[model samples]
Target chain A: MTTTAQTRAHDAANLGLLPIFMAAAAGLTLLYFTGFAQASVYHDSAHDTRHTLAFPCH
Target chain B: MTTRIFASALFAGLLAGLVAVLLQWSLMEKLILEGEEYETGAKSHFAGVLKLNEDGETAEQAAESGDGGEEEGTTRRFALAFFATFVTWVGWALLMVAGFALTERYGVRITMKDALVWGTAGFGAIHVMTGIGLPPELPGQPAAEIELRQMWWITTAATAVIGFALMGYGRKPFHFAAGIALLIAPHLIGAPRLDDYSGMAPPELSGEYVARSYAVAFISWIVLGLAAGYFWNRLQQPPA
Candidate 1:
């Protein structure tokens, strides 16, 4: 027989597909902003040497 | 293990950054700018050279004759730069995952909810900035693509803010689709191409070029995000 505490721990660990997918999704989401952070390295057409970050939307 | 996770994030970032860089440099430039112009302009395109043929002229002569344009020599440098950028991308992602998770520990939001903010920061802030920044620095500056810049930023920002907000509002089933939409909506709008050399024989083929390029861009973005996510998950179990 499974211990009640063990079962609860297992349930908490799972967090369902939404959380798992979100965790995965979040990685991608953060990439967008950090990718834009690359822009700070590039200032329009005036300067050169961009850091390779991009916001595909922009 | 914690260190390994951190390292993985770094690796992921560098790979992500490098891939993002390459996509921006090779693929993005081609679809948006090169599609309109036949020439690769001041920079280079590895693929565009395929369209060029040099039957009669010397290799150098043909290349100069505007028939052979390839980024042959700079491959090593670009490769190195790509590797470094990829590392940085992972670093950024790791920082985000860890930071957001910590905040959630305080009950700021559920872990899933926090992930949403992380996604916004990634999509909204990072990619656009990088795209706008890097190209000007490469050797042989093309004419400052000013009009294109304005057009890109305005529409891109609008789509990002509105798109992500809606995605966030809707959540769940909306997440993946929203993420994909937010990713592509800007690029699909067609970045301004001056002197584009992709050379659609009939000119109308431009749509095909745009669609093909945007499709590639979406795929790359998705890959970038997935890599970061997998790395983040591996790192999560590291003992603090």
Candidate 2:
């Protein structure tokens, strides 16, 4: 394989680390704001989402 | 190649988002509004003094009277829902594409059929397996502390994903056994739960909520996976 092709393949093979970790961080932030944040500041914003997901909220 | 992958991923994400918005609207929105009524003291599951006294009428009667149907704004709610759905599926699509790329690197055959299986596995890891411990909860339901519940939820998802990865890519007997171990580990640890199930929402409502949530997750993940796979395959084709 040409150097460029090998490099591209190598990058693609390991391509997920950044995206995966970023997704995890974003997921955690959304989960926190939607699921666990203090009621007054966070509850209303996530109300629709929480219900849509059927998460427990009182 | 990079541009193709991103383009496919973006389109798949948007498609999944639209599907999710439609599914949630048709299936879960009413249940949610009803649950909200109960949560906000506009209704009660069991008839009693605790029930809101709109001229001593029941919740259903009060609702029929039009005293309860006056929501502040629905347009805002739907717009937010669409945005959230779009963002979430996009993130999921990116992850899905990355996962496929990783598997391809390890010599696993990538095909549309195989992508469907991957989609199922993704559902299992993110929603089904984790939900085994923490079934969807309704409004006004009591729950374990958020920290503990969140911890268990993340752990379960992580364990399930690793287990699935091993099962798909592992070559040796030891790898297989280890994969099985990973799958079972989270459940053995158990999800955090409330000591008592006391809550304002009725048991029946909670039951329905859990079932519907699982149903939606199953459908959404399947479609999302298939669509992503289809796009990826199409994009990978060489120009004529």
Candidate 3:
């Protein structure tokens, strides 16, 4: 099968300069955002947060 | 004097991204959740409000699934968005410079009209399409729950038709308009239903939101691309 640009991958190009910077920034920023497994609710109300798989769920 | 950049590009790209997310939330999230919310024949159309730490259950009564399998979903989404942002931005920017330079050398010099076209196609079109297929919701939802139901490729055809046309035509403005059309068209067609919360999220909501997101992203990238392209070209130029 002929290789197409859409599916082709280039290791060097894959981590281009802008992406490298953006990812580093985003990762560091995410570390600061703070996420946890759970929080409590007073009355069985639906607003309470729950545990679910990360990104894997959606 | 300092060079000024167009605000339109930045605004458009961010708008596009926002619209894409909103569309998923309003329309597809629920329908997607509805099918997923059902854990058993007897109960749970949705899971809402986890007591957490103490253990709770749902898909039978989600006020908004403040947390559930959706936690997993949200995390994944965050990662995807982060990665998409990082990758697409660099990949497209590089491609854009190459494309523009090629055209200038062979076809025509980069112009505002051309800017709109290519930007829409690259930054706008690709993303909006991916957004359309996403399971709708703000941060939480289920992957298995939001099954594509054999409709996965529905967007593929749309992408090819639109992608190629814009790509093949290759002028700047036409590419831009086509890019906008691809983003806007599905919303106009009405968003996919998010039947999860029963009546909480309205149908067509997902598509509309996605449309706005596309608008924002397109605008933002165009500004970035244009500035970067022009600067790079000048830096590479020899004394004249």
For model 3 chain B, where is the 10-residue window of minimal lDDT?
B1-10
- Report the lDDT tens digits of candidate 1 across residue range B83-192: 54454455455655454344334435324334545554545444443244322112222333654555575466556655654565454786758765975776766665
- Candidate 3: count of backbone clashes, pairs at least 3 residues apart or interchain: 60
Which scores better on DockQ, 2 or 3?
2
User: Residue B24 deviation, candidate 2, in Å?
Assistant: 0.5
Q: lDDT per residue, candidate 3, B182-217, as tens digits?
A: 655655554344555532322354344334444445
Displacement of residue B155 (Cα, Å) in model 3 is: 8.4
Which is superior by lDDT, 1 or 3?
1
Candidate 2 per-residue C-alpha lDDT over B40-75 given as tens digits, one digit per residue, 9 for 90 to 100: 567777776567643776566766887443665676
Please list all clashing residue pairs in model 2, or write none if there are none. none
Each candidate: fraction of true contacts kept? 0.06, 0.18, 0.01
Q: If you superpose only chain B onto the true chain B, what TM-score does each candidate give?
A: 0.42, 0.88, 0.42
Per-residue lDDT, model 3, residue B166, is 62
Q: Is 1 or 2 the stronger prediction by lDDT?
A: 2
> In angstroms, how far off is B222's CA in candidate 3?
2.8
For each candidate in turn, the interface RMSD (Å) is 9.1, 3.6, 11.6
Residue runs of model 3 more than 4 Å from their true location after superposition: A1-57, B1-54, B57-87, B101-107, B129-137, B141-212
TM-score for candidate 1? 0.40
DockQ of each: 0.08, 0.30, 0.05
